[model samples]
Target: MNLWTVQTLVPLPVLVPLFAAGLALALHRHERAQRFISVAALSVAVAAAAGLVVAAHDGPVVNDLGGWAAPVGVNLVADPLAALMLLISSIMLLCVLLYSMAQGIADGDGRTVPAARGAEELRRTLQAQDADADESGRRDVLPVAIFHPTFLILAAGVADAFLAGDLFNLYVGFEILLAASYVLLTLGGTSERIRAGSVYVVVALLSSIVFLLAVGLVYAATGTVNMAQLAERLPDIDPGVRLGIQTMLLLAFGIKAAIFPLSAWLPDSYPTAPAPVTAVFAGLLTKVGVYAILRTQTMLFPHDEKLEAVLLVLALATMLVGILGAVAQDDVKRLLSFTLVSHIGYMIFGVALATEASTAAAIFYVVHHITVQTALFLVVGLIERRAGTTSLERLGGLATMAPGLAVLFFVPAMNLAGIPPLSGFLGKVGLLEAGVVDGSVLAWILVVGSVVTSLLTLYAVIRAWNKAFWQPCPDERSLPARAPIPLGMIGPTAALVAVGVSLTVLAGPLWKYAERAAVMVMDGSTYVEAVFPDGAPRGTGESNEVQDETEGSTP
Candidate 1:
């Protein structure tokens, strides 16, 4: 009954997956063992995150590492916003892992005879594929040996990023996920993955460098990287310098989040990876960047109205440009990728408004998008599995061949398009409501852009639906003959779709939670109090009384 009493489970979500990653590495050769570790680790993570979400609904719970308070040592925070994201992410990660395990039956069958057709057939069946060619579709592909551990590491990174109470730790979390992601992106090291990996690595490293520099400047200006401490100091810093720091940070995060001006790299790199990898990336990675922007911008610089104007303009541009690109694409994955970029504008719109209603709606929208978008990508993966190609020009007639696949695709597709009675529609409505609630000139402009983008998104999804499932398969001889989807793949996709539907079903409770989270972001004193029992203790060089909440030191 007392959610606030559940304060100490914060770090377990981050730590368990890390420990599991190591265990998974030790058992990589045993695919069955790896599956057990992956599932168990993620299942525990989801439990931890869910408990935290229930607890965070009351307020934030700070778990100071070594029992040391902020501005001195690390702390894991489970604010409503962070906990909500973590819960959703953990659930998605678990489902995707199951999907990967089922789809990833790696290495050949249990027989070993050099050049034997059975072994060779098994190898080709599990061989990782390079999706570089536009028309060339899905294939049996990539290293299952390393998948479990690498994926678990990525999961840890995601948890770390959400739970981190300071900027440096957040950056570390981003790096953790990024490093693991490099392996996933290039799974099985196909030529296409190699080329795609190169571009991804270069862009990611460059963004990290910018983020590092921004952190340095923020420290130089404010003398602390703790978000709560920065909140108190940022108001006093020179406006020009603060603005500069904000721009640099946003540019870096924007690039990572694939916000319009800096979004070109995404469609190119994401579509080249294997479907599951692409699904997870599409689902989680960019959102981390959006989460960062949400955290830093709202928590650090909440009052700068001038900066708000700039963000509003960028939001409008991001929405319009991104959807327009989506409309122009002939490939389903690329179209989805572009739509992903466009929707970030909606979140940014809420961020720009800086009002409680707007922020809450934005937070709610993020959760909805994460679920729907991920489910859609998972369905796309299934499509490739059944049809062999993602190219709209090369795909069709699946409505009959795999009616189940069509239903799986249809729900998320409608949700993504903001069709009525779907989570997508509710999310867009919330954002629109936020914009209307704001009623400023720029907010109104963003409102128009948001609506148009949604309409365009529906068009794009319909186009994809028509080409991929409704229409007859083009060049039937080009693809390997029709095959039934694995229960593993279909089951996970269905689970996620159900999860997305649940968002609409539970929209009221979820929105209420988002409201609670937005309040925490707006008022930093509560967090400061929660983390450090004593008031503002930055640069004191003396240990303030850290809240004795967590179980112990993190390994």
Candidate 2:
């Protein structure tokens, strides 16, 4: 219970953001104050997560809430997997916040406008003003104030989900982020955004209900929602019921992760949001679902060949279907969104293989994808800003006109396509190698599917690059050169692009850490022992027995 211990750091990622969100909301009228609050909070979170990553190298760091122990009171656990995710996500969140702030998003009410119209004009107008409208649009400024607080809340929600020790807490975490996403997605009240937000809301709500039902079933069956306890109790439940619960959970998370067949909503939903919002969503949200699947599959139900086989099939379909969607897209944002869906399959593939090596590869891939995907979306945002449109046909000669932007787009694009020595390639290589080790007929099939997906992904992104930067503008009059791209905006995008590269530079250590984390994940005892060093109480509801420690209070 020391103030500076790793246990104490477990909840900071969640608490700091929630506390800052309240402060940010209070100071919303002062955009500078809001920005400072958000930046400082996320910075602190990033630092805390880094500490946890090192501390958790020893084992999972558990913080029991109100000094209550596990199987009763809720706790936050930062194991290697959770800490790794927290660190990467916090970094991404901080970078995107800086990018949005630089883009002058805080000064403007969210609204769509033609690129030829200066950003200054769009920033000052929320809706069409009446003839008697005053020169200073005070109403417009108030709407822009919502961004900081909501974004912080979203950050906290993601952290909470990552560190959540119990199924109910995980569900709560998903709802927190999803609710904030609803607002962010529909910020401008544009018809398209509103329509897309509606669909998103419905789908998210449906998934939440399914997840809740799964949690309820879990509690009923095992009499405990804490994951550490569930890991011990789940195998003891009826196989049929366990299978049903597992399927329901997968179905819920699959929808969120945008695994194909359940992914139709994503391309439609994400492209409608503002660039920063879309970038963050593309980077973090779906991976959260994938993280959940990884956690539950490895921890709660290890060595389930049936589920693994089904997952492999879904993984192949997701990769092929998603890339095909991307190949057909004309708009840069939509194409990136589809690629986002497609790359998720790689992570799923790593998970379904369910070996220590494959799990490690999945972890590495998630880190790589989160950084690379967010960078790509942010680049697309820049493309939209410069050209006034993201339509591939309308964009051209950007390699000459904005050589910096072209380089910015190309690095992450190739990295995403799994080019050599890049983090993306390293991550993919890890996965493909793991699949080969497995040597099953299905694994071999997925190996082939994965390579095909990578090639097609490269083609999809290169096609986008060729059309947007290489080809001549379809109509010369459509694009008017704009003012110099802001340094603030370029700084964060470049920083993220740099992080993606750094992942490659750091891949040796990263891969080793992922391998260690995977060993911890594949061996559930590492997590269960960390949460409850002594054997945990095994029981159903009030019928269960409890043991007391000298300082412990029973639930």
lDDT of 1 by residue, 1-555 (tens): 453456558887888999999998886556678788889999999998988988777678888788677878888888988999999999999988877766655223421111111233334534322333235553322254677788899999999999889888988998998899998887756577699899998999989999899999988887788877777778777889999999899988888888878888888888877677788899889989989989988888886789889889999998999899999999888899999888888889888888888888889888988888889888887776677667888888989888898898889888888998877788788788888987889988888888899999889998988988888667767665444467867898899999999999998888888888999888777777776667765431112223222324434
Model 2 poorest 10 in a row by lDDT: 109-118
Q: Can you write out model 2's per-residue Cα lDDT over 1-555, one digit (the tens) per residue?
A: 343587889999999999999998887667778888989999999999999999988788999998999977999999899999999999999999988887774334322121212343343343343222457744334444678888999999999999999999999999999899998988767688899999999999999999999999999988989999998888888999999999999999999999978999999999988888999999999999999999999999898999999999999999999999999999888899999999999999999999999999999999999999999988887887777678887889898889999999999999999999899999998899999999999999999999999999999999999988999766766664444566877899999999999999999999999998999989988888888989876765544543334226744
Backbone clash pairs for candidate 1 read: 127-141, 127-142, 128-141, 128-142, 396-473, 397-471
lDDT score, residue 70, model 1? 80
TM-score top scorer: 2
- All candidates: CA RMSD (Å): 7.1, 3.9
Q: What local distance difference test score does each model get?
A: 0.81, 0.88
Error of 2 at 323 (Å): 0.5
